[model samples]
Target chain A: MADRVRVKSWMPPGHIRTPAYLRGKTGEIERRLPAFPNPELLAYHLPAPDIPLLRVRFTMEEVWGADAERPEDVIEAEIFAHWLEPA
Target chain B: MPHDHAPHPYRPDQDGPLTEAQVTEIAIRELLIEKGITTASEVTAEVEAMDARSPAQGARVIARAWTDADFKARLLADGTAACEELGIEMGTLKLVALENTETTHNVIVCTLCSCYPRNLLGLPPDWYKSRAYRSRTVKEPRAVLREFGTRLPDKMAVRVHDSTADMRYLVIPSRPEGSDTLTEDALAALVTRDGMIGVTQL
Candidate 1:
């Protein structure tokens, strides 16, 4: 079964992989990606640790509400594990 | 495109004093060379290698997929490995091949920054790196596609990939109708960089 996830709405000031527009939006996991050094930490040359990444697929309706051009149209993005929470 | 006319439209850097960015670049280059980190010849060679890349490399892959079903399956399964199988150096670039079907159209964008399959398609276009294109592609893809003169039926679902992380995205555009009998090289010639980017169809 495809895992359902929601992007966390946090806006902490730092280098983040998640887009602002996708905050608080829920989507299905399209696929799980390999772990990589977190960009948020790597950006500052901090002690970077590997983090899991997932490609989450969100429908236009979920992302844009009534302003969506079509309900079925989709948007997929790679969200770090920290940015994703179980919906 | 330069014209050897009396009036030159472009004033190259030599026409004026070096800009701050250019000066900084020269300084860094000199320091790096002095420190034995890299040589000017290595930099020039790297630039030459980059210059050797173009959309033709990507077109070859697309054309191969069009003519060979097995290759297309492999490409969809693992884009980087599939490209490497064709002797294209993908380096550490992971790729996801989004196939554009009749019922759906696929487009790629990096809303965070300019993430692209540069190895296959060469450099990303100037418009692809602009904030307007980045923001609008996710918000209003249909409108942006219309601006590119690509109009799909309202019923067709548009899938936009916001490459916000490690993997770069490429749209494998469907082969045009009535081109089944064409040779692979001929079909490759028909493929355009815009088509691979999902901005236009061949």
Candidate 2:
């Protein structure tokens, strides 16, 4: 079964991995990627703990709504675990 | 405002005017070298190594994949290892090859920054780093692809891969039709940088 999750809309001020457009958007988890040090913290030269990353898939309609050129098109993004919440 | 006429520290003919970011980079580099963090020769060697990569390397990989089924399987399964089969050193970074099929097409973008498969395809083009391409590709890919003169059929599904993490993506474009008689070298000649990036098809 695919894990469905929504990106949390947390707008912190700094270098971020998650794109702003995908924030608050729901998507299906495609697969789990290997864990890596938190880039958000790494950018600041802080000790960054390892975090799980997931490849999430969302339809064009979900991201752009009526403005989407092709509603059936799919987009995948690599998002860290902490940025996602169960939809 | 008190103005003093002084010769600029930067040699006009050799260095030109450095941007603030470039000046900061120089400062950091000099500090690191001064502190014995790294050597100037090490930095120069790294830059030269990066400069050696080009799209031709990627084209050769694509050509081999087109002709060899087992190689193609290995490429799709583990891109980094597959590249090594042809002696293309991918270093420690992970690479994923997305296959374009009859029903699905793949495009790559790094919305947060200009992350790319520099090991295979050299430095990314200026347009790829532009704000318009970065922001618009995710929102409206079809229009963007169209602008690049790559029009897909309405039935074909477009899949845009956002390279947000360390894993770099390389699009394995479908082989062109009616080229069965061509050699691997000839077929490789047909592959373009844009084709590998999924902005256009070969």
List interface RMSDs for the candidates, in order. Answer: 0.7, 0.9
**lDDT, residue B43, candidate 1:** 95
Reported per model, the fraction of native interface contacts reproduced equals: 0.91, 0.89
User: TM-scores for chain A, candidates in order?
Assistant: 0.95, 0.96
Q: How close is candidate 1 to the true structure, as a TM-score?
A: 0.94
- For model 2 the local lDDT of residue A43 reads 95
Native-to-model Cα distance after best TM-score fit, residue A53 in candidate 2, in Å? 1.0
lDDT of 1 by residue, A46-68 (tens): 99899998999999999999999
Clashing pairs in model 2, backbone N/Cα/C closer than 3 A: none
lDDT, candidate 2, A6-80, per-residue tens: 999999999899988899999999878889999999999999999999989999999989988789898999999
- Where is model 2 more than 4 Å wrong at Cα? B1-31
Candidate 1 residue runs with Cα over 4 Å from true position: B1-11
- Determine the C-alpha RMSD for candidate 1 after optimal superposition of all C-alphas: 3.7
**TM-scores, one per candidate:** 0.94, 0.88
